[model samples]
Target: MTSPLSSSPAWKALLAHRDALAGATAADHWQASPERGAAFTFPCAGLVVDFSKQPVAPETLALLCALARERQVPESIEKLFTGEPVNVTEGRPALHMALRGDEHAKVDGVDIRVEIQREREHFRAFVEAVRDGRWKGATGKAISAVVAIGIGGSASGPQLVLRALAPDHEGPQVRFAANIDPAELDQALAGLDPATTLLVVVSKTFTTEETMANALAARAWLEAALGPAALAHHVVAATSRPDRAIAWGLPECNVFGFAEWIGGRFSLWSSAGMPIALGLGMAAFDHLLAGAHAADLEFRSTPLERNVPALMALIGLWNRDALGAPHHVMLPYAARLEGLVLYLQQLEMESNGKRVTTTGEPLDRPTVPAIWGAPGTTGQHSFHQWLHQGTEAFACDFIVVAKAMGSDPDRHARLLAHALAQSEAFMDGLDVPDAHKACPGGRATTTIVLPSLDAMHLGALIALYEHKVYAQACLWGINAFDQFGVELGKTLAGRILPAVRGENAALTPATHHLLGIIHKLAQSD
Candidate 1:
């Protein structure tokens, strides 16, 4: 069966162009054209993305943009901004863009701004009370720490942002627990004073197994330390199920509600960002939203060639499909952005890591590449050797801040040098006589340079990828918003839980035997 995407005129053009550029090195391309670097780089706000190191010519990019045109990407982006049901399978608009508070968007003829403004007021009042010591714990003491209980998007999104903006944080110390394993929660809550700790439980459904487990454990810990009545003073909920939150003994006033249309992975902009407002002030949070809004406007207005996110998406498609890259690495030089890859992994992989289209037809090409990486300088010691000399070729993105927040300009300069040197090294390798010292050149890398590691820049960086993922999904003819892929594992784990507990015998022998060994080990403990 012929796929619509592959059969498109633009796709045929790209395939022909790919064959025409076979065996051409990025270095060769650069040598042939003096203006390759300036010509390939694109800017959005203060962030500049240099995509020259990817194995793409001007014609390659033109053809990819043609593919986007054939796929009607601009129209899809319009649907995203206008709050149409872009997430067709789920029958929702995927309106996380509205949460950023710049668009005057209304879904289904209802003014969403009214509810958004109401929630913003609620967020500001609640955050100010907590951060200014006006909101006291049950013991009449001001809260000094916060424990965020969540899993997946609920846990990762706010936690990632909290870490990214750590240098700007002057409010309560923030902690996170996302695992069902008690050890993780124990470690996070180890030395905290329960009396002065506030728990923010974030689960859109109020029924995530790991999040609810951690939430219950947090409740028990707080009750054990501050009494059952203290729950009202210290616990708050960010969820769609406000009634369920209240039923769990949290006060109605402490329950924060966000719309169901806001998926967990894209939820940090919503009331799910309560912990963010508590850690960094609501003003800083507002700046973060404003920064993202700036990128949203750019994505809406900028042409595909000059659009940073669109260009990034086009380069990625070329690398994955045309260049046959199997893996992608995210190397961020800033220490504060340690969680950036974790956030992007979910954003990209969970959004596009599908084997089938929205209509359940099998895909002819790969979707999302396997994304993995760590913070650099640290990662350089661990994987740079393999990346430099390994047999496998992978596409990479190197993120660096142009300016450091603290003093010591020399250190920041060194970080910037490392980022540039790595990208350059990927293109220009040493040709040594000895095989051990020789390097294979022509790997692909995109360098993303942010003006600084401030919340605003970070917000723009994040929104850039959010739009890139959307663009890629549009090009691939798949829905970027739905994730039915994550449910089967959850369902299987639930089926296995009873067997592990020895409460039922309707289990596979292999699982039952494994449970016996686990149970036996537990008894010894």
Candidate 2:
């Protein structure tokens, strides 16, 4: 029986080929072809993707494509677009695409597109009311600030949107609080009047520990400034379980219900994205969806050979498996993309960093490289040292926007120059005389060029990575939608909470000792 994937003929061929390219350097490949830059770069949906500096030869790409064919990548793409229940463990189709207008998906023998539109209309009404002062605070004041309270995708998507698109859009003073730490909520709520503040609590289950904790705290803070009656007008929830949200002391009208197929990380496209509409205008949110839909079409219609998302997945797989790089870094030259790395950490790692296959068999290979990074030229000062001279080499993606944030052409030109120079430096290093200054630059890097940073561009950028993660899971034979790995930590934290409160709950010796010290410190305080 074929147990591990390594036993497959295609997997074996890729493995054999991995060893043959062991001695080659990225510099050698960069010099191997005159058309390397033109041949390796591809454009789709107004974004340019350059994979020329990925430490792979044309032969390696051909072999990777052959492996993709052998692994049925085209079939996987069809399965995803056709609304198959690819997320087998949950017995549900990951129809987040339906929220973006995938016409062919049906949930429970009923068309979900109509339901998605209904939900969107329902939430859009609420957003319009808040934006227009029709939905006033309990004290009859129009809200000027909106504090989005959610953990993970719920907060990250909205925060990233507000930060990236803040220059172009004029909306509410949007802020996000995700950590259970009191300081985080304290800072988010600091100096804001509760009468002019609107709270959006997002959770799929209405029961996420961190989310609910912050939600309750924010409610209490708002109640202290206003009254208990203020919660009806001051707070709203975006969740699948609207009944539970209403029961948790929100008005029924305040709860925006979504379908169950929306995974937390992918829910940004669903009603969980209501905060995006609230933070930006409904028009910006609509543009975000339109941009994502365009990418969805690009991924759906383009063949694997020319598909941008497909090529990203295949190249990522080659870097992770064949080239043996364990870390991938994101370096966006645009300051607006500051949160892009954190967004991708949860998007890629939470989705594909799995140990077992879909059928519950152990995987013989690493699933995902550790996804982490910072915005550049900032990262150039911080982690670029490690990227250039560290003993371990990593895969990097340099995201550069052609247009600057403001009208300062000189600063933007310098930023663009530094971005290109870094890529070149990474590809072709200086063979200097001084040993301390010598930099061995054989790192694999990809340059993704965006015309500008906007809601539409952000939408396409996010969708590209989302599909890439899903395709990587398909290639690895793992369930990308299910994230059972995060449960154990949550469970342990639940049991440990009582210990922190000075209760005699069960605990390991190490934990008990730690709790003792914690209690002693609290007593001193």
Candidate 3:
């Protein structure tokens, strides 16, 4: 039960190099040093990670690789793919990947794959029925729009994929609402006929605060317009808690259950992906899985130095720890990938943003950077100025889909040009004599080029980021499988509800002070 960091020689070496590395500031020296680049570059999933710009040496990487090996990183990965209970705290296997393929792979002689495949098949049939106009509303109109209701992983993952693959899409107009704010639900439901709109409730537990609230609101809206029979046409629930969904009046046939093995953030391949499958189709969904499987195979079999996910993780570690960078930006050049940054934020930050290791030991260093970004061209107009001239140095990942799925060749060329220009500008920043205008020429960045914006490539890209998060967690000695950090605020909110309703006793002094301001504001309003 000892934390991986305790026994890692690489962690020790990294700690030892702290003083020397702090004194080093020249990016050129690191890049020119053959020894440095040789150790830094690693390939996996047919992608090359050039970490030569990073400050770590070859010996450091070898030691880190050794640390990973010693910690049974390979075994952990195999356990994940083969469906072992690697999510030890939850007593479940993390088998989101199995949702896309054969579930025959076993762990402890149990086959969870069959359950995942069954859900996928059910989703596929639903998608087909809707697309073919066989699934009609109470008014006998074909479904024309979809309102996906959920928060966090349920909303972010499918929303990202749908937006990214918009060009290849030929289906119903899809909208997602994740915020708990009443405005978000109101806006998503506005101007759409309740009868022709499909409301997909995507909470795994079927009882998420935001999702359930929105579901209730949606039900009120639909019943107001089309009556109780509208519920039969408008609702579909994605949850492990099928009984809860059924209790809420969703038909058992419309309730898709994914296994506990699929964490919310990684559940896109499971029934949580009903929105994605509905927006696209069975073929597209399958392609997305196939792409991820390709990346998975490559990540498992490749050498450490050539492993893409490994190299990405190590380079990220170097940036966060060695250079003391606090933020990591992901700028996808394609407009289609606008939501990708949000998706990655959850995938990377939620998974590894831990204060303690798996064994409950305090961490010696910061874990996980603040991940944020937007699509380029648009972001260039807004935030590129800060990125180039700001005091803070944030590492960036520039993602480019190699070929545009759009029909306009000219537009595609312009997109690619912007992507290349941004990376180049970041790496080779121009010098300005004006003190306020000067650019820091040594900003670090990594470029990820997907072959195309097809479902398969998008799937691969997502899986690549997923594996990178996992590997980094392994190296950092944290549990990538759990997210206990999100619970504190929720617990506090629940406790405050009765107080807000004035049903409880008078608040404590600190709480009274806040309530005084609230009462004053209510009078002013």
Steric collisions counted per model: 0, 0, 6
Q: Candidate 1 vs candidate 3: which has greater TM-score?
A: 1
Candidate 1 stretches with Cα past 4 Å from truth are: 1-4
Candidate number with greatest lDDT? 1
Weakest 10 consecutive residues of candidate 1 by summed lDDT: 1-10
Q: Point out the higher-scoring one by lDDT: 1 or 3.
A: 1
lDDT of 1 by residue, 1-525 (tens): 124566678888888888888778889899999789999888897789888888888888888888888888888889899988888888998888888855688788997988888888887899999999999999899999999999888877888888888878999999999889999999889999998999999999999999999999889999998889999999999998999999999888999899878988999998888989999998889989988988999999998889889888888888888778889999999888888888889999999998877777888888889999998888999999999999887999999888775689888888888888888888988899999899988889898988888888888998999999999998888888988879998988989887776687577888778888889999994
Model 3 worst lDDT window (10 residues) = 22-31
Per-residue accuracy of model 3 over 354-386 as CA lDDT, tens digit each: 988777789877889999988878999888899
Worst window of 10 by summed lDDT in candidate 2: 1-10
TM-scores for all predictions: 0.97, 0.97, 0.91
Residue 482 displacement (Å), model 2:
1.3
User: Per-model C-alpha lDDT, please?
Assistant: 0.88, 0.85, 0.80
The C-alpha stretches of model 3 lying farther than 4 A from their native spots are: 1-7, 15-60, 405-411, 431-434, 505-508
